[model samples]
Target: MTFKAAKEFNTPVGNYCYYHISRETYPIGITQIKEGNSVYIMATPEKALCDLIANQPGINLRYKKEALEFLEENLRFDMDKFCQFNPEIFLAYAKNGKKSTSILTILKLLQHE
Candidate 1:
């Protein structure tokens, strides 16, 4: 499932989008973040990383260093919180080599970098 912002709505926060796999429908690694009086159900760092790779099939994270740079610089992921996640669940969603390899590569980089 894919959720995109409607053009009819305008906000200073820009557009928000999300993609989810149908089989993995259960809401896992999701948390609530409040801003002022509004609360939002957002995915955890782990879930967000998996979703990023899954949604973008053409992503180029060829090497460990590349993955590190992408996650640290391009994405700015929270490493401490990310490492706390269960690696097994992340691997379960990475069906093919594309997302799987990328996730694995990032995990490896997390160890040394």
Candidate 2:
């Protein structure tokens, strides 16, 4: 699937637009599928993989330092506590190298020079 985001909706966190739907009490990551019309998977990891592996088809929410910090501060050791609660996504992230992936991307967005 193509990773497409609304150009008009960039967030203060940068890059990935905030997935706000109003009804959602807690803000969770969301990808707007124009074709599938699915809200996509929540920010959790396990369901993200399940959605993709099971062929649910959703874009991954890109995050860097701020996101990691948020996850670390709020989530800590338990991976499932994040929103919809998926663990495999974290595993996939670790396998793919989170340091180089979103972490680098995060620094670039926040750099002030």
What TM-score, computed on C-alpha atoms, does each candidate reach? 0.58, 0.25
Q: Where does model 1 exceed 4 Å of error? A: 1-14, 18-20, 25-41, 96-98, 111-113
What is candidate 1's TM-score against the reference?
0.58
Pairs of residues clashing in candidate 1? none
What 10-residue stretch in candidate 2 is worst by lDDT? Answer: 19-28
What clash pairs does model 2 have?
45-86, 46-86, 46-87
What are the clash counts of all predictions, listed in order? Answer: 0, 3
Error of 1 at 90 (Å): 1.9
Model 2 misplaced regions, further than 4 Å? 10-42, 45-85, 97-113
How many clashing pairs does model 1 include?
0
lDDT tens digits, residues 1-113, model 1? 23333234346977554444544432544679999999988776676677677568577665987886787788887767656766655655554323667777666665554
Query: Candidate 2: lDDT of 58?
Result: 32
Query: Relative to the unseen true structure, what is the C-alpha lDDT of residue 65 in candidate 1, on a scale of 0 to 100?
Result: 78
lDDT of candidate 2 vs native?
0.36
Best candidate (score: lDDT) = 1
